[model samples]
Target: MERDSTAGGAEDLLLEDTVSKLRAGSLHKHELAEAMEVEQEGLVEHQPLEQDDLNFEKWKPKPKPKRTLHEKIDDLKTYLWNAETKEFMGRSGKSWSLILLFYSALYIFLAAMFAGCMCCLMWSISPYAPTYNDRVMPPGMTMFPHVDVAHGFDVAFNASDRSSWRKYAKALEAHLKSYDDGVQDRRNINCEGNTYFMQDDLEESAERKACQFKRSWLGECSGMKDKDFGYSKGKPCILVKMNRILGYLPGQGTPVHVTCGVKKGSTEGLGEVQFFPENIFNLRYYPYYGKLRHVNYSSPLVAVHFPSVPYDTQLHIQCKLNGRGIINDSPTDRFLGSVSFTLQVGA
Candidate 1:
């Protein structure tokens, strides 16, 4: 019985210790709740202050400071030339040098290629004669005082006007300047009148000698005798010459002659016409070798003189070349065969 009573007493002590631990735990939980509530109240109070600061900052934003003109120019200058970065015009010095070098080399190569092509083309061409003469075949005839009118040759002037006729006379004077007797005697040889002066052999200077054609052969129509070329006297002289072709033999052995008359269907009458020296182109000027070979070469001239053309009349005149191997009537090319012109004399 005594042992049973001691056991009951130990059980009561254990229950009391358990109850005390439960009470201590409840007090600690109550203190933790109070500390959490105090911290939440402090956070709630700071939140409104933070929101007011944000609203205040949004209401009035700080303005950007305005730069003066001098400051802006200074900024632009710094952008154009940045000394710290060693850059000019938005590029570093080394980068700009490389770009300039690349373009310079590219342009130099292109210029060299162009110069090389031109040199090769020039080397293939003959200096003396043209490479192709197909378009210039059969040759063409031209006249001095060549006044162009509506795609055709026309000579119209007042006979009494010295200013008008003086230009024609001056043109003739310039044309015949190379054919002067003194110039011809020095540069050319006097060949037979009706025979060809064939120069098969080249001279010591690697050139062929040309025949002399003195201005004196033109007689009264020559500017040497009459400075006016008969224009002031109402008698105008027109000089005719044949175009030169390389290695071309015109008229064969026969003499080429010029015949001028009123064009067909022309109402106006052509008065008396005269040819200086003769109406013929002498045979000595044939078989032209090129400009380089035929040095000092002068094409022979035929002066046609209108001794008595009617005053105040426009006469359509056609001068034709008549000889063997010379095509004088080409349908397609009017200038290729012969030359036609309109003549108007004013009082």
Candidate 2:
């Protein structure tokens, strides 16, 4: 059966306006039936479009400002400067804060040089450096300081000690004994039947004898150099330092040997041998600290007795090494103290 939808709806109550229009004969029946078969929901309202609103001008956006090269450079500089400041200031110092760097460096360098010099002064370079090369000791016996072979240095083995003189005395004695053994053979020497060798009594004394300076230390540990044949004005001296420790015999005319111990030491850049005085009282045939020096131990000493003692008379002593020639006429050195003794008379 074909049913009409508006047939059961009340007029002016719930019926659609289309139905009302059809009942009033204003709507056509075929249109109403067609409308009933289709959707009869609420109207789909749409706003009317304005003519101006529909107008579409060409779409365009404003141009942005571009940064200049100089601006970029400025920004980079600021960033770098800030970074550097933060790094350096954190340490409470600046990268260029080493203000006295040059002076500090110089101070360290000089200090090192001074230390090196001191070390050299205290040590030797070699043990057999020829000290008497080209130059010979004077005719008499005398002393020549430890010589540096490469440079022809004739000076003592850096004798810088003045406190204990005798501590090195035994070594001096041993060195002399060795030198004697090396230079001359004491083998097969005939000291025939009960032949007792006697020392010169002139060298005998009841008490120990020592050499001491009157008021000053006798040029102790003097740093001198090898000069003309003798100690003119420029030469090194190995002045003995004496005190109670040294065998100082407080009498007149005591025979004493000042054995200078050649203390051995080494250093860098030097090629020389150094020795101390094993020669006492011209122990060798040379001068000790004066000119035209000669060694005495290997030479002869002529002794004479004087009836009259020279008051505060100064006597100079020197010597030569075992294997060298020297002179006794070196006139530069003089006694370092007051005269308290004289040579014994020889028969």
Candidate 3:
């Protein structure tokens, strides 16, 4: 019976130890559960705070640094000629060279086209003849010793002053120098005065023959006999010439004649008018070819002499070309077929 009691006591002690170990295990599990719940709560709160910080950082703008003048100059220099990229004005050297070559070729093409057009224009036109002659039709008339005034040329001079008339005489002398007999005979032919000398053929030098107008034909007005041209004696000589028209003929049947008279309401009369070599332009000089064809052609001249112009008085004189085709009455063209001048002589 004593042995059975001892075994039962040992069993009771072993059962108590097992129960204590189970209770301790239960407490550890409960504490671990509570710690896990607190940790989950802390993670949720930290996640929202971290998200707010991320949003603030995303919306905030970065501040720009202020650059000094030297820094700005360096930036400009880099833009103009970048040492790092080897670029000039935002373009590489090779790129600029290609662009330059393209523009150069385009300009060269344009210049060549322009030159070709000019060459074609030059080839199309002749150098000897004019392309247009509309403005030069019918021709015009002019005079030498052409002193201009309000109404017309004023051939006024004091007879007592040699200087006053000397220039007029000199002008006449110079005008007649080309008409010298020796000079005319050398370069021109004495063609028939009443008919036209039409030359369709060109000479060996490719020129048409010109007519001779002798200086002696001017007679007293010629500078050979009277060097002063009567200016010192209060009488003056005036020369009249008609402008040449290319391929134009004047005076169909009758020869073109010049007639000088005192204009109406003249204060003084034009006294004792005389014309040298007659008042007509001989038909031989008509139908003038161009300057290239008629190289030595000299236009015929008619010299008018005023022997007794009233002294100390002004006289209005008009010289008109009387011809069928001439338009002398046109008020619009005062210088077409006529030339008028004022003459005043002082004793």
Report lDDT per candidate: 0.85, 0.30, 0.84
Please, what is the TM-score per model?
0.72, 0.18, 0.71
Candidate 2 on 1-347: residue-level lDDT in tens? 22344555445355577677667775476678778665544232345656876766633465778989999997777655556556432332454356457678989999999999988965754322333344322222222222234632223221233222222233323333423432433321212222112222422222211111111111111221221111222122332321111111211122233322112222221222122322223221111221111112122222111122222222232222222221222345222221111111111
RMSD of each: 15.0, 28.9, 19.4
List runs of model 1 lying over 4 Å from the truth: 1-72, 147-152, 193-195, 200-205, 264-268
Q: What is the lDDT of residue 158 in candidate 2?
A: 16
Q: Please list all clashing residue pairs in model 1, or write none if there are none.
A: none
For residues 230-265, write the lDDT of model 3, one tens digit per residue. 888888899998888877778885689999888766
| lDDT value, residue 24 of candidate 2 | 74
Q: How big is the positional error of residue 2 in model 2, measured in Å on the Cα after superposition?
A: 99
- Candidate 1, residue 346: CA error in Å? 3.5
The candidate maximizing TM-score is 1
* Candidate 2: C-alpha lDDT: 0.30
Ranking by lDDT: 1, 3, 2
